[model samples]
Target chain A: MNTIDHHWQRFTLRQKLSRYAVYLVLVLAFFQSIQSVEVIPEFLLDAPEQMGDMFSRMWPIDFAYYPVAVHDAMIETLNIATLGTLITLIFAIPLALMNASNIVNSAWCHWISRFFLVSSRSVNSLVWALLFVSIFGPGVIAGVLAIAFRSIGFVGKLLGEAIEEVNMGSIEALKATGASWMSILLKGYWPQVLPAFFSIVLFRWDINVRESAVLGLVGAGGIGVVLDDSMNLFQWDRVAMSLLAIFIIVILAEIVVVNIRKRLI
Target chain B: MAGIKSVQNRENPFKHNWFISAIWLLVVCYVLYTFNAMDLSWGRINEGFGHASNLLGRMIPPNFSRWSLLLSGLIESLEIAVISSICGIFISLFLGLFAARNMMPSWVSTPVRALIALCRTFHPVIIAILFVKSVGFGALAGILTLIVASIGFIAKLFAEAIEEISLKQVEAIRATGAGFASIILFSVMPQVFARFIGFSTYQLDSNLRNSTMVGIVGAGGLGGTLFSAFQRFDYDFVAAILIVIIALIMFGEFLSNIVRRIFR
Candidate 1:
């Protein structure tokens, strides 16, 4: 009896070469990043101590301060998120209609809507808040606008994708009936996209809540204002309270969104 | 005959869902309440539009005179994003395996799931602020904050990916009498490795977007420069910074898309 040699390898020579190249690039990138990211040794060494110190100060949470400042700020934060989501729906629906390739066949429309949506998404809410704060002078209006602007991109993009994914048969049926464009949109696409639309809005609203909570840091008005104020004052206890409030609101918002989305989709 | 007539008769094909109506009513009520509670006057909105146009006009031509300063801030953000993503992906690779219900017992997975959820609950900006307080600010704080975020997101997705894998394949690997680690390496890893790559690239993209802004809280990056630009009313420079950030995020998205295709 004779046995022939057997060999197995995960990749061909070309694949191996490419994989090696990728690894080499990653290694170089990592080293370049580490060198550029100057780490102060003292600060690095004291991080644990600093954490411990902060935690110590945060202990004995200022429950009393919650009612005084955090409560109203928290409520305002909720309002901002809700109002922002509602406003987003207004702008987003039209933009989404234009963006969807299935809905608007014009190449020009797609480009214009895509540009608007991408620009909206590219700028972070904080940056938007800063811009709006300058224009609106830092208040609920700025906060609401910032949230709405940022969300238009997200809500519009997802809604557009949902619109694109609808069943063509139903749409064709509506068209065959000699329905007008508006009627077809209302009778055909609307029902199909409604579930997706609800879920996306709820999801975006959930995110907007967390986002608005921090817009106050930029003076857009929300819990972040209370948080920034307490932090600046070195009122560690009050900061702790505000943080707690923010945490609870976030969890509650998550719960509500999950419940609603489950029932919806 | 009456029963047949009544059965065929319907006002609307769609049943009126009370749940949806309630949600709509609630939304309307909330918006109305918010308007009443907040002092968002129509006059203020009109005046705001004037200031907005003025601000937009000033931002034109996007001053690149301070190109060198802009370049440095952009580089720092890139470095923060790369470092944090690398560290975060590395951590999540292990954390995800532990959190997967199919791979681990209930006791092990439950606590890890809770930890991931806790990490996910807060916004990265809030986390960045806390890290700034603790780590005394710098790129270190940003890196830490983003690492937490990346872990929270990627690990959950990874665990979910793991949970959905075919257990039949795993049982087959076991039938061959392979060791635990070998079984994972041969059977489980093959199924999930592609998805893991996808998640890592997505995390990198997210971290890049987030790293650009963490500097707003002084954790480190373009944020501080951008904030200062705003303070000095350097609208042109601010516009330039924003342009750079948008370009950076879009580039990250493109890069991730390529990476995903490669892995796929």
Candidate 2:
């Protein structure tokens, strides 16, 4: 019995070593990558002091800025999110249908739709903003377009998956009743996916609110324009105020979205 | 049969809610207001399209003459992403365990949950700006920004995954008189490991994308190069950078897909 126990212990020890060996290799690779990035220890050590200094400079938040510039910018940001999400939903519904494998029987069509979604999603909204800013010559128009284009892929992809996952039984039942394709889609697919579609749109809007707030950095027009100006001018107090406003807005959006999703889903 | 037929006939197939319609009406009004505020016009749009065409014409045949600069920036971005993902995933693993309400006491879990939420509140761009200011700018700032973003994202999902795990296995391990560490290792880890892999790979993909953008704020990466090119009106170089960025993102997506497949 003692010999058997000793053998078991040795085997467990060997297993542990082998398991940790993989983590060891990963850690080694992490260190090698870190070297390329040149994250010096000295700079890391000084980071805290620099942070403290910056915080000190940012103290006494500029409440005066909030009533005028920040307020208008904040409203514009909200408008951007709302309108952008609405536009995305309009475009995404058709794209989602085209991309849904269950809806679109043709393989080529499905692949083409998927390709469009992937390419759109691959490019960041900021990059899109940059492109639109060049074309539109800066303003809320560019911001709105950037947000709408960026959101199409995300909304389309999720909605497509939801559409594909709808109960087939109901669809088949509608089809067997000699229903038209439009009726089948409306009566069969729409009801099942409406809940998910609403939730996705709301969630995307919440995200877009966060994104559009920063679109002004690229001259797309929003609160980010004020933020960019403040940061560049080294107006630390105003920067602090803007950041606080952003934090509050994001939290509020989160709460509203969660409550709505709960009620809907 | 007669009663059922009467009941079916009495029920409306479509139930319309006035409340929902009112909400939609409000939404439409708000959209119209926003449109009016933005001062959108067809003439401006047409002029914009002409400018767009000119820009596109210049962007054709991307110039890769500064290949070395682009290559180095791309490599740095890649490094920042990999390193941050490794660090973020490692830290999130432990934080996630602590944040799990089922695994830890409320007092312990609440603060960790709050920390995760706080991390998530600000965009990576805002955080990158802060890091760039404090850390004197470079790949280090970008890496730090992504690490915070990753923790905020993965920790929440990871904790939820842990909460969803069957406690029966954990209880059984405890019955053997195992220590906290041993039970966590032998039981809880097995259940959530696959999902943890999924979250980590997704985080890696996101970090890769974010690393490219952080450089726009001087945090270091391909974005810095791209931003400078745009400033110089080097549209060809900008086009080249955009092409590389798109390819990099797609490659990251492909790689993560394989990782997910293997794990799944």
Which candidate leads the pack in DockQ?
1
Model 2 lDDT tens row, B110-203: 9999999998999899999999989977899999999999999999999999999999999999999999999999999989987998999899
**Tens digit of per-residue lDDT, candidate 1, span A1-265:** 2345556787788776766776687778888999878678788888889889999999999999977989999999999998998999999999999999988899999999998998898898999999999999989999999999999999999999999999999899889989999989987899899999999999999999999999999999989999999899999889889889989999999999999888777
For model 2, residues A102-174, the per-residue Cα lDDT tens digits are 9998989898888888877877888888889999998998998899999999999999999999999999998
Off by over 4 Å in 2: A1-25, A40-42, B1-10, B15-18
Candidate 1 clashing pairs, residues 3+ apart or interchain: none
* Model 1 spans > 4 angstroms off: A1-16, B1-11, B14-22
Residue pairs with colliding backbones in model 2 are: none
lDDT of each: 0.91, 0.90
Q: Residue B73 of candidate 2: its Cα lDDT?
A: 91
Fnat per model, in the order shown: 0.74, 0.66
Give interface RMSD, per candidate.
Answer: 1.4, 2.7
Error of 1 at A215 (Å): 0.9
